[model samples]
Target: MVETVVILGAGWAGLPLAHKLLKYTLPEAKDGLKVVLVSPNSHFYWNVAAVRGVIPDAIPDEQLFLPIEPAFAQYSSENFEFVLGKAEHLDPEKNTIELVKNDGTQRSLSYDQLVIATGSHIRSNLPFKPIGTHEETLAALHSLQKQIDVARSIVVAGGGPTGVETAGELAAAYGGEKDITLIVAGDHVLQASHILPSVSQVVEKDLQKLGVKLIRNTQVKEAQTDNAKRENDVAVAQTRTLILSNGSTLTTDLYLPLFGVQVNTGFVPPSLLDSAGNLALDKTMRVTGTKNIWGIGDVGNLEAKQLTVTDAQIIHLSSALPTVLTGDGGQVVKEYKPSSRKMIFISMGKKYATGQIGEWRLWGWITAYVKGRLLFVDTAEGYVGGKHLRHASM
Candidate 1:
């Protein structure tokens, strides 16, 4: 008997897990196992460097997007299937899921086990994550770059890593030629509760050195694009009128909002989700109240949404899943332990960076070398090629 395992979403978490199971677990299963991966996009987007990707000519399209289907060429057809669609419905009681294909067709799949890794999307329509299909994401990236190329003044909202990195990229490319302003809602940027106050101070200095204008303690309440304005009967480029929280209005040639993420759990059942709509998960990463279903990555509420945490969850589940599937009573299922220490690195353009691990702050040069220079694009292909499985095994 062949037991099918359906994994949803092929982003940072789902893609790697599929590769691991196909390489390490499928061959070892007593009952034959098959892995089915479902995603809305046909390509794997390396969105870690999306901040710099919006900057013109910083990175090529080939390096940023990889075809997802070709990566699984090593696996046999009997063991793996990649479906290009979005998960529209999930019924755990029947162990079946319904997906709406890109062509507007529907398909129903039954699974012995399910893994939810739909991840999250940026609040605004940006290329930070897979907004839709591969072509749609590519179009968004190119459109934003073209806008940045001609915009004389740009306003970036939400003082997090994306906003900071974007401001840095603009400053590095255009210097004082263009006016780039970053609006921070709180007193400082990188204002996550876990981050130390000192880290924000250091980041502030880095942005200032890059000639990024910082607007502190302010928020963008509303932004309206005015495209009909003309000067001397000649049409001008569209501009954005921003209404600030401080009762002030500022207009700019371009506006970029990089903040907040809405988890992609709309298709999940309400009973399995928390009040915030994130999937409720146990310590073992299994969906709460369900045995064969598991939730991970940004869709689950076990830990903060970060790539390191997502990677840790993938490593743990990949090791523990085989025991559950094969009914190996002798082997124990290891519970996932969330990391308490704060670890993050923010790259300010291509030259400077800032990071903190626990209570220690990393030097700018060290961060730049490790993350700022390339944004980990070099290792992105490994995730798709099943090479990450070897690294995890060791």
Candidate 2:
């Protein structure tokens, strides 16, 4: 009897891991193992380029979101399978996972091993979240752009990279046509403490030069989570209101919140989650207290959820899985070593960016090229075929 390897989520870690699983492994170790990918979405969005996506008509929809079917067509007939839906429930004790189909039916698949990499979500009006299809996303993005075009006053809450980038982009794109204000809860943008002091200062200087008003030590008192409602209000509201924790009221044409990232582990039980709803994983990327289930990417409680770090995790798992899963005893298992240094590529716009490589902060067109230019949309296109499972364009 062949064992099954079910992987949940088709993000950075899951897709690459699927490719590796198909490339290596000789089909069987006494009984063999098959791989199945479960996801509710049909397109693998180049979500990193969302800043550019929010910009009206900046890039084409095909560049931003690539259908996964083209990528998976590269693979020949094999033991791999893709379920068109999301995991509704996971039962480790029974070794079975249930997936809810698009038509609202539930399908259960049993597996000998499982990997979870559902990723996280961010709350922002910059068209950052993943939608159903490429065209739908593009249409919504155009709406956001229209709102940006006519807005007289813009109040952007949160000092994270998205907020900073949006503020800068709006100023640069509009050329001081709109009054752009950035409000951060921390001492400086990017949480200040998270990046080098000099790097943070440089970012602020860039925003100031772009005519963006920086308001530090402030948070949004009125929490809004509905993206559709946000869009509707942006089109309808002649003047949007933002109530701040500092007791200051902002009247603006647009209120964009670049705030918290919500982890996508709601399908999972709390027993497998941390305090923040993130999947709890051991040092080896194995889910806590589970011998066969692994967690990776933003969904896991890893120090860094960057794509590079997730790739490293996949690399380690590639070498470790065969020995651990094939019933081979006494195999040396390598523990995942997460990078101690912090690395980030934050775009001020397509022209400028700020980055951190270890102790050094890289700031120039190089940063812009690395992450800002094309927003890596072209790079993401190279990885379309890894996830071949698509029932719908969405």
Candidate 3:
């Protein structure tokens, strides 16, 4: 029997891993291994630029979704496959999983090896991510954009990367016209947590220049949206309410919260995950005590959750996996250590950004040219075979 390697969730981690595995392992015939990518979404989205999508006219919904089919077309059908489904349950003892399709039909897949890369999802609905088909995602983006378009005042909760980028993008696009307030739970934005000190300084400075009101050392206590919505049982709270933990309140037309990303690891057993659903991972990205499985990307308890870091994992896996699968395939013999140098890029709209690689800090213009401009949406197309969908706006 030709052993199959099953990958769940085609997010930042799963998508690249799937493509590279097909490119490196299957085509080269790594012991006749078969690879299958299972995702609920039809498109392998570029989440790196998802924050820009909230701006009224910044990023079109069409540009984000890349057809996964074209990216791995070179691999023969004999060795590669894609499944549109959600993993409902995993029976690790039996090495089989129950998957639910779009129609609510269930199917069983038995894998010789399983890779769980089902990255994180923001709890609040603010157009930071699309949950379903391309049409559904398009509608979601439009709705969120509509909220932003009409709001006279906006309150953004969470000082993390997503909230910072959202505030910058919105401020850059509609600074003078709208009132934008950024509420950070820490004294300084970015908090330089898992990033460089210089990056936080530059990003906060640029945001201040953009006229963003920074409310430091405060956390959101309540959020109430007039146009509240619920989709797929996920509450699109807009993270509104404008209530602060300090007992102050500001009534805003729109409230966007960017923290609290829920890991799609409900299928994972409780014993394997922390209270927050984060998996305890070994040096080799394997779930602790699991012999035939590996966890990657934000799914693991890594400090940095950038796209570049996720890609680095794929590079390591493309080299390490072959040895493990060919050998005992029991204990993960391959080792991977995340780079000690703190690397990050915080884009402040298309004209400016702040990024640091190790001790090296990049200027705003250089950061803008590298990743701030278009938020790397252009470069992302290259990763998935550069397939341009005509239906997507130019």
Candidate 4:
């Protein structure tokens, strides 16, 4: 009998791993080991570029949407298949997974080996406000575009990269016609990062030049929407008047919330995840206490959830899976160690960006060209086709 390999959640983590597994033929492997990838989406999304997606002149959607067939066709042999559905339940004891298809059908699959890359989902509740999902995200952007089209006063909540990026974009695009105010709960933009101090200085100077007001050490305490009835549509209120923790209030025609995201780990049981419901893994990316199981990328409880780190994790973990398959279950095992490189790219709206490579800060058009330009959307297109995107046209 041939061994079976099943990978769940064909997002960033699962797709790459599957492709690599299909491409690499193990030396000690048995005659036939079928590889199966399970995902609701046939295409892979470049998550890092999601923020840039909201920009008016950002990369086109076709470049960002990658189909999985080409990737599999390039790397996989005849023994690989893609199941168009979601893994609803995982039965570790029986080494089986229950799948729910988009067409409302169901099935169970047993895998001799499994990888759980079922990435994170947005959380609805937090100290910060909520941003909508899918169509909601697009709708909010459209409505804001309309508001920014005419309104003079705009108040943005959240001081993180998302907030800062939005403020920068608005200032760059509509600064002459709009008054942009940025509210940060902390003292500086990108507060949680370890970038050089000069980066923040440069960012603030640019925002000041663009006439964007920076309010630090403040939080939105209360938000009242322009149309109260539409408040429900906005995850946090669709506010016109926003009251701050510092007892200050401002009235505006448009409000944008750039707070953090909520993780949806409910799809997987808590037993497989940590106390915080993040996938708990031993050093080898294997789900703790679960046999023939692995976890990677944003789904894991690891501190860094950036796409760069996630991609690295997937590459490292997938390389070890072939070794594990050659050995008897527990006797021969390989340990996995994560890398220590931290990289972040922040889009300052328009076509400008600031990237932090370790402790050094590199800014300007190169940053924009590298990531801020098309958000590596063409890379996504290439992944789907299983060919390297030599030139990703912006």
Candidate 5:
């Protein structure tokens, strides 16, 4: 009997897990074992560079998008399968999942073990995540770049990393040429619970130096387009009127809101989710009260959604899954413990950066060399090739 492992979402979590299993676990496991990866997009999106990707000629399209199918061509069909579709529903009781394909067709799949890594999306329509199919994401990116080219003024809402990075990129590209403003709802930016005030202060100074106007303690209440008229069936580029929380109105040529993140858990059952609609997982990354189903990446509520956290979870789960597949009752797999030390890296355009690990603040040049220079796009292909997994195992 062939036992199947069905993994959902091929972003940071599912893609690496699938590769690791085929490369390491399947060869050692019982003869009958296979891995199936399902995702809405056929391409893996390198969204870490999305902040700079929006800027004209900042990063090429090839660096940001890579086909998911070709990455798995080395594995034989008998051991691996890649399904292009979105998960429509999950029936944990039956160990089955329902998926809706791109052509509006539905398919059902059953698995002995399941992994949920569906991740999350930005609140607004942005290229920060895999917004839809590969073509759709590319379209969004191109459209945003075109807007940025022509826009004289840009307003970015939300004080998070994306917002800060976007503002910084615009400032760097068009500092004295265009108007760039960043609106932070709180008194400081990078307001994640673990970030220190000093870190935020440093980031603020960097942004200010880059010529970004900081609007502190203010939020965008509403945004209304000044014109709805279409030019030759396409909506014309029009000014946006933003109503601020402080009872002021500001108009800009472009408005970008990078605020909240909504996890893609609609297919999951309510009982398995936390209050924020994220999968409730134990330290082992297993869904609470479930044996065969596991959760990772932004979809899991175990820790904050950071690339470093996601990478750690992927590495831990990959090592643990082989033991989990054996169904040995007495053997215990190591539990996943998230790091308590605060770690963050913010790239402020091409020239400057700021971040901290634990209590130590990284120098600007260190951050630039490590993250800001290429935004990790150089390693994008390695991720698809499972180089990270091979390196980790050694």
Candidate 6:
């Protein structure tokens, strides 16, 4: 019988791993390996484009959905399969996985090996969900587009990378007539990155030139939308036409909270994680205490930020998996090596971005063109064997 390798969550990490395993997996082994990718989404989302899509004239919706079938064709083998379902839980001991389909049906699958790559969820307490789910995100974008069309005030909460990039793209799209303000509870934006000092300085300058107001060290206590908004800061409450955090009141037609991201691991067993609720992994990215189980990407917490870090990790693990499949103990007798990792890449707009890589601060349009412009939407589609879609207005 052929051995099955099941990968959960076909997002950033799972898709690439399935592709590599199916393409490069050796067929010589009598156990002929089968690779299965499980996820509810038939298409992989190039999430980076969500922010840029806020602009009415930006990328179109048809271009975003990269159907998974074409990408699977690149492997050139029937050993690969796509399971359309949500992973309900994982059982490493039994080497089985539970899944729930869209129609409320449930099933169990046995696996010889497993990979967990379910990504994280957006974090916001504003009674609104993150702008990732297709329906919710599109609704938010449409609302913002309408606001922009009417020349309304735009207020973006949070000053992290997502917030900064979102504000920049929105400002660039609407031009100066769009009243934009970024409210950061922290002292400066991009503070989590090593490039914060210099990059924040330059980005701040650019934002100022673009007529964006920066409110620093201010926490927004309450946000209510009605005929008017009433905002309350620490020890201060005021009713005005528009109000935000930091004991200040300002009117804005649109309010977007880009505060933080929440990880959805409820489908996974708590025992699989460490004290911090992160998967415990060996140097080779295998689940420390579970045999034939591997964890990659954000769920793995592999000492790298989620995003592209998951890509490199998947490559690193997938390249070495063949050895394990053929080996006696199912472990790579030789060591595994990780590919080069890019530290951080920030997209300012259509054709502009800045990033840091191993003590080097790089600035250019290459990153934006390669990633920021379409967020690899067409590329992902092409990889998945879907017809290439046209680029949306940058």
The prediction achieving the highest TM-score against the true structure is 5
Per-residue lDDT over 278-335 for candidate 6, one digit per residue giving the tens place of the 0 to 100 score: 7877777888777788887777655754464554576577665776786745654344
lDDT of each: 0.87, 0.73, 0.76, 0.67, 0.88, 0.68
Which residues of candidate 2, in runs, are more than 4 Å off? 26-30, 123-126, 131-142, 192-194, 223-238, 327-332, 386-394
Q: Write the per-residue lDDT of candidate 5 for residues 1-394, one digit (tens) a residue.
A: 7779999999988999999888888887775679999998989999988998888898989998999999999999999999989999999999999999888899999998899999999989688888988888898888778778878889999899889999998898787898999999998999888887787888899998988999999999999998643445644355999999999999998899999999999999999999999999988888999988999899998888888677788888887788877654453777899989888988887688878999888888898898988898888898877777312531
User: Regarding TM-score, does 1 or 6 come out ahead?
Assistant: 1
Clashing pairs in 3: 223-240, 224-240, 224-241
The clash tally of candidate 1 reads: 0
User: Which stretches of model 3 miss by more than 4 angstroms?
Assistant: 27-31, 226-241, 328-332, 386-394
Q: What local lDDT does model 2 show for residue 290?
A: 88
**Candidate with more favorable, higher lDDT: 1 or 2:** 1
- TM-score for every candidate vs. truth? 0.95, 0.89, 0.90, 0.83, 0.96, 0.83
Tens digit of per-residue lDDT, candidate 2, span 199-219 = 787888888888999888888
Ranking by TM-score: 5, 1, 3, 2, 6, 4
Q: Which stretches of candidate 4 lie over 4 Å from their true place?
A: 26-28, 74-78, 124-154, 228-239, 328-333, 363-365, 388-394
For candidate 2, the 10 contiguous residues with the lowest summed lDDT are: 385-394
What candidate 5 gets wrong by more than 4 Å, as runs, is: 228-232, 328-331, 389-394
Error of 3 at 73 (Å): 2.3
- Candidate 4 lDDT, tens digit per residue, 252-334? 87677667554545567777877777789887777889768887767787556656576567556666777677655653556
Pick by TM-score: 4 or 5, better one: 5
Better of 3 and 6 by lDDT: 3
